[model samples]
Target: MVRIACLILALILPALVAADVADVYDFSDRAQEQRYRNLIAELRCPKCQNQNIADSNAPISKDMRDVVYRMMNDGASNEEIVESLVGRFGEFVRYKPEFDSRTFLLWATPAIAVFGGLLVVAGVVIRSRRSGSESPALSAEEKARVDKMLADQDRPS
Candidate 1:
């Protein structure tokens, strides 16, 4: 029993000792550290859609963190650093991609769809109104036929 317990402990000990090395970010200054954390939080982890690179545990997240840190240490401004990364990875890396020609539809598509739906609804309303106006003056023969049908129904029980 003691030997079995010892084996179990040994097995578990190695697993516990193997730490996740990607969480550590070495920044020389508090400001740079804050900037690095902020940028990483704003940037999406390509491997994990729901998490920012700062909070992700994936290797790709670590690599992205390293890239941001390197750019910061090189004295790049926050905007410049973000631009550099965006340039390398494209708009998909950003939590909010910029609105440009290719992505114009992204921001405007919903509004355009709403406008189109309104136009369709207006067209249907206008068409219905036009049809109602044109048919208001039913032919005398049609009115006589409708009156005979009503008279027959009225004469029944």
Candidate 2:
């Protein structure tokens, strides 16, 4: 039946696609495999900001995975692998960015904004307190008019 064929196709497609994964690289040891996993998890997929290379099915992510595997197999250090990728892809490749002069603003922006907001609020509060303590003096004519109005209001209806 067409329905049976469609269901079978749906089930088999994922396995066929998963067959294309970066598992082609053979690790000599469990530690090497774990390091490869960690590197892939830490690297972001260029096409998808929220997904790491390990979880992304994007072509770029697959390529990144391949590169990481190859680098690890060649006995490259983690920092060396990361730095090389960072050179090619920019610092956005890492989920946790390294701190440097260029990245200091990225890390500190939120705190700076909060501090600026608090300063603004303090200014407003200071203004309110200053304004509340005294009112502007009325002119003599206006004072006389207000006194007359009060006197009229106080009289028996």
Candidate 3:
């Protein structure tokens, strides 16, 4: 009887787990609900870099989803909603960052780093070729000494 009770409890335990998802939308129109899903998928969870608000377990993500749901219910446009979030959290909260003078560095930094690496590689290759092509100069006395050593070596075993 004790084993059967434990097995029943084990089977029922999974039913108690709750994800903090917002109430399912009962929008008069279907498109608005779709838009809400898309918007939540686009917004990054602040506490979790790799997860969107829809998929994140963080309370912040749940709160952000609630905000998005409320904004959609209030008839806010997608752009307006996104702008509100960006205004509060800066551009980092959005998966797609907007282009502006301030973000030029963010977009250009990787290309600049690649170009800098290529220049360094080219400089190293050029320097190595230059070094390898230069023959060491020998004094006449040094050449004579080298020749003498060769001659001695060749004379007998």
Candidate 4:
């Protein structure tokens, strides 16, 4: 009986918690509503590390959601809201970082490394081909020994 009651509580607890957080804000326009949803999904939760603001249940996430709501209601452009949050929290608040001097290495490092690796592989292949095609001539004694071996093999052995 105790185990069954505990299981029921565990199952129902999340639904009750979710109901308390469903504070839906009405938008004056559908476009604004869409914009708000997009912005929340794009912004990262500073406290939650990898989670977006919309998916985090942390208190800081709630505060950020409220800020997004207020900013949208005030007719702020998407860029303005993003810039404001970025200014307050640094670039870490954005899921997709901009291609700037600070982040150039982050975006271009893999491509540069792959290109360098290809150049090394091509160099090695070219050297191997060149060496194989232009092999050193064998000494006359060595040639004679190889010929004798070939003759021996050819004889009905």
Candidate 5:
């Protein structure tokens, strides 16, 4: 009876402790709620680094969510909301950063890498083709000797 009580308590205690209470927000409509969701999903959590604000449980993420909600309530445009956050947190908060002078290299890196790979592949292909074409053909005497050796190998010891 004591063991059963201990087991039930142990299970219940962990479940209670592990369950996180989610933050609740009152939006005027479903569109506003969706916009809130999208904004949070697009914004990265500065404290969490790899996680978006929507997915992060960090204090900073909660604050950011609150700010987004307040801004939306005040009739701020999506661009205005994004700009405000970007101004406050720097461009690092945005999942898709604006293509500006600072971010040009970042956006161009994939293209540059692909072009470089193509050049390397072309060089290898050209080199292989050249080497293959330049190889001297075996002489008639050499072919005859190879055939003789093969015939000898086929014969019984």
Candidate 6:
């Protein structure tokens, strides 16, 4: 009976410990709640670089969500909330960073890479065409030797 009790407790203990407590915030209306949701979804978590604050379970994500809730209650606009977070955490916290001199290269990298690949492909094609067009002609002696080999193959012993 004690062993069975211990087994049950071991199974239930992990489930209790691994359970996440979701954040509960009271917004004035559905619109406010929705706006809060959108803002959190748009903001990337600093600790979990790939996940938005809304989807991340990191402690920093929870703090960020709290700040967003407080700011919304204070009647801050979405842009203002985003700018404040950006100011605090740098542009890395934004999933889609603003277009600027610093980010121009980031945005332009795909195009540059494609153009470079095309140039490499074009060079290969041009070189192949040039090399193929300049095939060396066989000398008279070589042609005669090839003809003799073909004639020998055609003759039965």
My TM-score estimates for the predictions, one after another, are 0.72, 0.70, 0.68, 0.81, 0.72, 0.73
lDDT of 2: 0.90
lDDT accuracy of residue 14 in candidate 5:
95
Ranking by lDDT: 6, 5, 4, 2, 3, 1
TM-score of 6: 0.73
- Taking every candidate in turn, the Cα RMSD to the unseen true structure, in Å, is 4.2, 5.0, 5.0, 5.2, 6.9, 5.5
Between prediction 1 and prediction 6, the one with superior lDDT is 6
List candidate 6 segments past 4 Å from native. 1-21, 138-157
lDDT of 6 by residue, 1-157 (tens): 9999999999999999999888999978999999999999999999985999999989999999999999999989999999999999999999898889999999999999999999999999999999999979999999999999999999999
**Candidate 4 local distance difference test against the native:** 0.90
Q: Give the TM-score of candidate 3.
A: 0.68
Between candidates 1 and 4, the TM-score winner: 4
Model 5 RMSD in Å is 6.9
- Which sections of candidate 4 miss by over 4 Å? 1-19, 154-157
Provide the lDDT at 153 for model 1. Answer: 92
- Candidate 5, superposed: residue stretches over 4 Å from native: 1-21, 135-157
| Candidate 5 lDDT by residue in tens digits, 7-126 | 999989999999998989998889989999999999999888789999999999999999999999999999999999999999999989999999999999999999999999999999
User: How do the residues 26-138 of candidate 2 rate in per-residue lDDT, one tens digit apiece?
Assistant: 78889888989899999988899789998998988888888888888788999999999999998889888988899999999999999999999999999999999989999
C-alpha lDDT of all candidate models, in order: 0.85, 0.90, 0.87, 0.90, 0.94, 0.95
**Candidate 4 lDDT by residue in tens digits, 16-99:** 887764648988889888888899999999988799999998888888889999988887888998999999888999988999
Number of the predicted model whose TM-score against the real structure is largest: 4
